[model samples]
Target: MWIFRNKSFKSAYISIIISTLIFASLYALSNFNKIGLSFYDSTSSSLPTKPKIQEKSEWLTNFVDPLIGIKNGEVFPGPCLPFGVVKVGIDTNDAGYTVDEAVTGISRM
Candidate 1:
């Protein structure tokens, strides 16, 4: 409040703040190389450094059926964790598939 009470003092205060910020930014940019910050390293080895992807076992889903409710079943079936609340499945109808209605395509719920 005191700084803004006088017009001259307010302009001088804002000018000082702006000049300080500019100086700080310029100083950081000028010393960027001395700071030892490297965006890319040309000396890195040519050996593959990519992370290994963990492959899921095919035997685990061998017995699981995702199309259980596509014909006559009354439930949307998909992979779900044990005791987990979230479930992913195809949402056909609110009451599920019946013998009369033909299922079109898979849809997410």
Candidate 2:
């Protein structure tokens, strides 16, 4: 009651209570499965299913591979993981862009 006499302290106390309630509600919703509560309706005709892995691989190999090489030897033409910081590939023009020969050593960019 003494703390609530100050406007700032009263507001801070109310905000803390509200924030705690919100966090608890969110935690309960996320752990609904463990609490024997199903968010998904069993009466629904179709159950959710994961997409085929092969289709994703094929799409990336076919579509992404060709588009990656469009930078005209400046970009590396080697296998690179998604969001990779370092890229390892052959340098086609180590001497300069004028020379059309592959460099012997691998370059990381």
Candidate 3:
């Protein structure tokens, strides 16, 4: 009890009380896992914007198949003459909950 009369003891006691109060306040708050108590979130206002293009549908004329290295495919039956367009299957990654490079269907090439 006599040691409490010292100014250092008084300072240490005050520090302990302040620390306990801080701990109690933090424990009472739900967001104590995060640092610096904030009443409101700054990032709650805005959301991310979507991309411009949604689907990939393009027409290619005189298209040559790169795999076979020959323009032997047909538009409907016989070999499509030069400077002719054809529909080719390709992948689209615009707006959908699907795997990347997932081919939807064939379109005009």
Candidate 4:
């Protein structure tokens, strides 16, 4: 097979195939209810509903910013949506490694 011709390519191809298969299986399993597989019986027909949003508190705010320290200050302290692809935050330092006096402009992570 073409995969056998190059050892590195073969390994990469196999890894890609395995990862794809794993992702596909997980995706199918997650959507089993919507796909009509019906893993459970009539008794479990009702799915759990989303939790109600409440007023934000100090405890909740500190939870996300768990990281601390000067070197570890790279952590973003801005609002970010759950499972968001782009992380919008401030870049404290520039390429020169000097910290900016003010947190200016949104940086995409």
Ranking by TM-score: 2, 4, 1, 3
Give the total clashing residue pairs for model 3: 2
Per-model CA lDDT versus the true structure: 0.67, 0.69, 0.56, 0.66
**Quick one: best lDDT, which candidate?**
2
Query: RMSDs, each prediction?
Result: 10.2, 8.4, 16.7, 16.7
TM-score (C-alpha) between model 1 and the true structure:
0.33
Question: Which is the leading candidate under TM-score?
Answer: 2
Report the C-alpha lDDT of model 4 over 1-109, residue by residue, as the tens digit: 4538778988998999999999999998899888677866657747676887775674577576343433445644546788756666665446421243565565677
What digit string (tens of lDDT, one per residue) describes model 2 on residues 9-92? 889988999999999999988998997889788888688877856866567556545435434656545677777677776655
Residue 54, candidate 4: Cα error in Å is: 26
TM per candidate comes to: 0.33, 0.43, 0.28, 0.35
Candidate 1 residues 1-109, lDDT tens each? 4546789988988999999999999998888878898555768786468797656764567778766665655554566566645556544455674545556666444
lDDT of 2 at 44: 85
